[model samples]
Target: MTPLAWLAIGLLVLVLLAIGLGAWRLRALSHRVGSFECGARRAGAAGAPWVAGIAHYGVGRIDWWRLWSVSIRPARTWSRYDLVIAGREPFVGDGPDTYLVRCRYHGQDFELTMSRAAYEGLASWLEAAPPGRRNVVV
Candidate 1:
């Protein structure tokens, strides 16, 4: 084969590998222990859904991983102690079947939108806090 042909084949293989890896990661993340689709808006980026990611709950923290990124590392991690739900409201314009809950985390001052079920689970987790911690606003 020509040198150009070899280079082209190499590029094609890389593309296929990337696609396969991305698909595998997305599927794996969806089925992972505590993952949920959540939209995030930076404190400075209100009125815009700047990021969409998955939130995975750990023992005492929730890790946010970007939906389209290939990295296994979380983009942001929030500790339960530091998280205080400023408020929650029904998210608008997402869809009917799956209702989204828009909430603001006090410490980060950022907004996150996730499914109703996910929100409920978060609320339960917050409410189950041990004694001595201040109340969480949900």
Candidate 2:
């Protein structure tokens, strides 16, 4: 084989190894951070698309990261005090076990689609807020 061909093969191997390492890192982060998969979109925006993401239940806040993104920072964060659950319904086209939760944060509306278990966990987290800090609509 030519020298150039050998170099190309080496580069391909490096790319594959980088991809594998990234995947492993993501999996490890999810497990350690206790993140859950969810979809979100702005409720009043026209032509808005649902974005799949991972949600981490943090102290007094929920941190959301785009699922397919390479960045380590959260794309959005909602505080427990600012978020109010307006209603919930079954999310069509996903599955029977999935649910759509409508919520308001500082008067702005948004929707979250997640599995039944995740919804329950979210509800519990909101309801568990400390005394004198509980204003959630649930």
Candidate 3:
């Protein structure tokens, strides 16, 4: 084979190695992304806090009994959270019974809705988070 052809093969190998390494790093990082709950199918509220890069949207306070969230794009909200939002866009429900919440974050808008059951679980996890933990995305 020509010297040039060998060089090309070496370059390809390097590129593949880089991509594989990068993916492994990302997976490791996500594993430590932090989940509040143990993710068990329990009778009462018990769920994990959905992690996002946007720190501005997160739980403000977490107590044993209640949680307060300053959600910019709350997929669901609970009275316990004291969820602070501006407007409700449309009637796009998650389903026949569930309601959807469309809100903006970081100059962009997105919508998400959850069932009454899911919301309860989320609230539980958020409230259970220890104190002094700020809701940060990153």
Candidate 4:
């Protein structure tokens, strides 16, 4: 084979290795991060489209990471103290068991679409916050 062919083969091998490593990383993260898949959209933004992501519940906050991105940093985070559930409704066309929850974090509104069980778990997490740590506005 020519040198150019060898270079092409090396590049192909690198790409495959990168994909394998990424898959391994994602699987390990899922196991240790306790993350749940969900869809999110910011409220009041023009043509705000729902983006698929995973939510990782932390000690006093929740971090969101885009599902298809390679970045390790969270795309968004909401403190339990400032997060508030504004409303909930059935997520149209998703299913009966899925719901769309409207929430406010530091006055910024966003929506999360999750399963019924996940929604209940989120509610419980918020309500279980330590006393004096929550700032209930309503």
Best by TM-score: 1
Superposition TM-score, candidate 2 onto the true structure: 0.80
Better of 2 and 4 by TM-score: 4
Report clash pairs, candidate 1. none
Tens-place lDDT digits, model 3, residues 38-122: 1111122224332232111234522111112222233232332343222332333234544333433333444334444434444
lDDT of 2 at 20: 81
- For model 3, the local distance difference test gives 0.36
* Model 2: per-residue Cα lDDT over 21-111, one tens digit each: 6687567557855578889999966478999888998888998887766677889999997788888989888999999899989888999
lDDT of 3 at 13: 100
TM-score for each predicted model, relative to the true structure? 0.87, 0.80, 0.34, 0.83
- For residues 36-74, write the lDDT of model 1, one tens digit per residue: 888787665655666888888898888898888889788
- Which lDDT values do the candidates have, in the order given? 0.77, 0.84, 0.36, 0.81
Worst 10 residues of 2 by lDDT: 25-34
Higher-ranked by lDDT: 1 or 3: 1
| CA-only RMSD, every prediction | 2.2, 2.5, 13.1, 2.5
**lDDT score, candidate 4, position 45:** 62
- Model 3: lDDT of residue 9: 100
Best by lDDT, which number? 2
Error of 4 at 1 (Å): 2.7
Distance from true position, residue 102, model 1, in Å? Answer: 6.0
Query: Residue 80 of model 2: what lDDT?
Result: 91
